[model samples]
Target: MNSSLTLRASAAALVLTAAMAPAVAAQPDDPAARSTIGVHARLLGEKIVPHKLSFQNTTVGGLSGVDRDPCSGEYVMISDDRSYLQPARFYTARIKVDAGGVHSVDFTGTHPFLQPDGSVYPPASAGDGKAVDPEELRVDPRTCRYWWAQEGDRPKSASEPVIQPSIQFADRSGAYRGQLRLPPQYEITMADRGIRRNKAVEAITFGAGSRVLTSAVEGPLIQDGPEPTVEHGALIRVTQQSRNGAVLGQFAYPLEKIFAESDPSSPWPPDTGVASILAFPGDPSRYLVLERTWVAGAGFKIRIYDATTRGATDVRRMDSLAGQRVVPMHKKLVADFADLGLSTVDNTEGMTWGPTLRNGERTLLLVSDDNFAEDEVTQIVALGIR
Candidate 1:
């Protein structure tokens, strides 16, 4: 849920202190520069964005994406409302941060995205193909225009129109600007031909200088394979394209095996996927990738991986990844949330580089999407990079 920049917060008395140690690495010789979010990381502090917070008629939750405007210094967050909670909109807010930690988050504005015809997007209940499931927001480093990712709809019963996912732009006031042309592979075709339902694009980012845009599919496509299971992990595609939509490259990203088994009797399916991605500052070839998973009884598992595309095969032409021999992106253990002592991880989905510390270190900021549930909270977690 990040693009332009990232946020950081604090206050151990009021927020959870995320004192996570470095996650265990597979390669014994893996250097931290290639393994963790930074050489060393520690808990800064955290604060909550009041549950069910409302802004301009929009429920300020389901915060799937966030990015700060370099010119304005204001952070923009996209809600995955699907036009249900308030016409598929976003919110602007100021999150105070420093060496001590994040002090406060004050939401300032809210705006709804306009359709090409100057209308608000309709809800999926209307069965229209225009409903949007906004996932991430990034400020166009060049134009300052809002670039966002929309994870399209997967028709539940064939009665609803299949909405192909897309990357689109909008002005600061939420006026429709334009959209990027997506590769054919992203089209919603069948159970084994294209993007999967609800498991399509979840994260997107503009590389340094806004030269390239990178996106991560939440899971394997129907043709790629099954979801990550306790027995083994899965493969998902990470696509890079020019702002105007020319395919630059596509790489395979191996997801980790499900960390825990779900309740055998639970009806809900276990889940695992990339929740957010941030391009390494000044380098598109490297990234800080976030992975989150949930089992029926085993809560949530979240981690940050220092990932690199160097030496990885560009699989843009590969038809399917199942049984393929291509080398995927290389990723190393970063930070695992299990090491943090928190009662509830709360469906954390967004990440960004936060304000720089007095020590010249950058703070890592995180936001959680409560999914508008009474039991959940809208949390903003801050960590220090040292």
Candidate 2:
């Protein structure tokens, strides 16, 4: 289903609450599991002033993905603005964290993502093929360059054209360097069996000493069964590629049902998908997958699942997953955003590991995309992980 439709449905039932309460730790299913990581999230008491954090002469909102620059203490965030409000761009910001929790967030600067011809994306209009829908951003651990994902647009009608999804690299200054050559399965086609609209590649991460780059689609390809529902779940492919863009392997990750039967439903089944993925600090095969959902009247539901491809079957060679016997990654629930007691969870989409706090624990940061709506707020929350 289209994300814009989901957002519009959710906005109709918006309910505001007080500040978020401290998060309660969730006990792992297995107390002695070393392969799994336990996490507890607490909403930062102070926000970055929703839809008002400006940098480089633009209001910094619609943050979809965020990662901390290893070299600098600053954090980089990608905005999915699609060159509507401004040219495609990213922003650098400072996030303060301590024993209590995330203290504050401040914007430092913004840089425009350049096209091959060395120009910012032109404003969206008819015949505008240069515009991009930037989704996730990551700083290359090897060269400190920035790699971001674009969930290219899918056509709405027969006359509308399609955009191909891509993962491109940019210098620290946001100059276009190159892009990864994606598999043919990811291409948006006029055929019915392809990436659903607004549901292309949305998550990307570098791991294995920065030798391996992994990207996951926001939902299953049209041929891969159906979108997850309260009765049955769906499967999405996670592709691992070399830094130079060669496909290495691909595995399946099962998406849980969008919502329970008791929860609210809309004209369309509320969509659920992997919003972001992060490789474990020392394990290339392990990752923390953030899955989020937005049901019309029920609001949002987000969960962090610790997943491993250690023994999962590689499906890269398979032409279609619809009827294949594939082994999915092992996943365990790590944290549920609802348990954090947030007043209202907006469109939470991005996640990354922040600097270690003074309390000697690893910090995890999650950001929300307010969709640039006045009724919603851009929220940045921090979680303490042991």
Query: What lDDT tens digits, residue by residue, belong to model 1 across residues 1-386?
Result: 11111111221111111121111112222243244334456777778887887677778899877887787887888888887767989888899977776799999998898988889999877876778888888889888889888898888777678888988899998899999888777778976588888888889888867899999998888777777666666678898999789999998776777877789889998877988998877877888788988888887777887777765678888777655555566676567766665546878888888778888888888888888888777888787765
As a TM-score, model 1 comes out at: 0.89
Q: TM-score for each prediction?
A: 0.89, 0.87
Which pairs clash inside model 2?
Answer: none
Clash number for candidate 2: 0
Per-prediction backbone clash count? 5, 0
Model 1 CA deviation exceeding 4 Å by range: 1-38
lDDT of candidate 1? 0.77
Q: Candidates' lDDT values, in order?
A: 0.77, 0.77
- What would the C-alpha RMSD of candidate 2 be, to one decimal place? 9.1
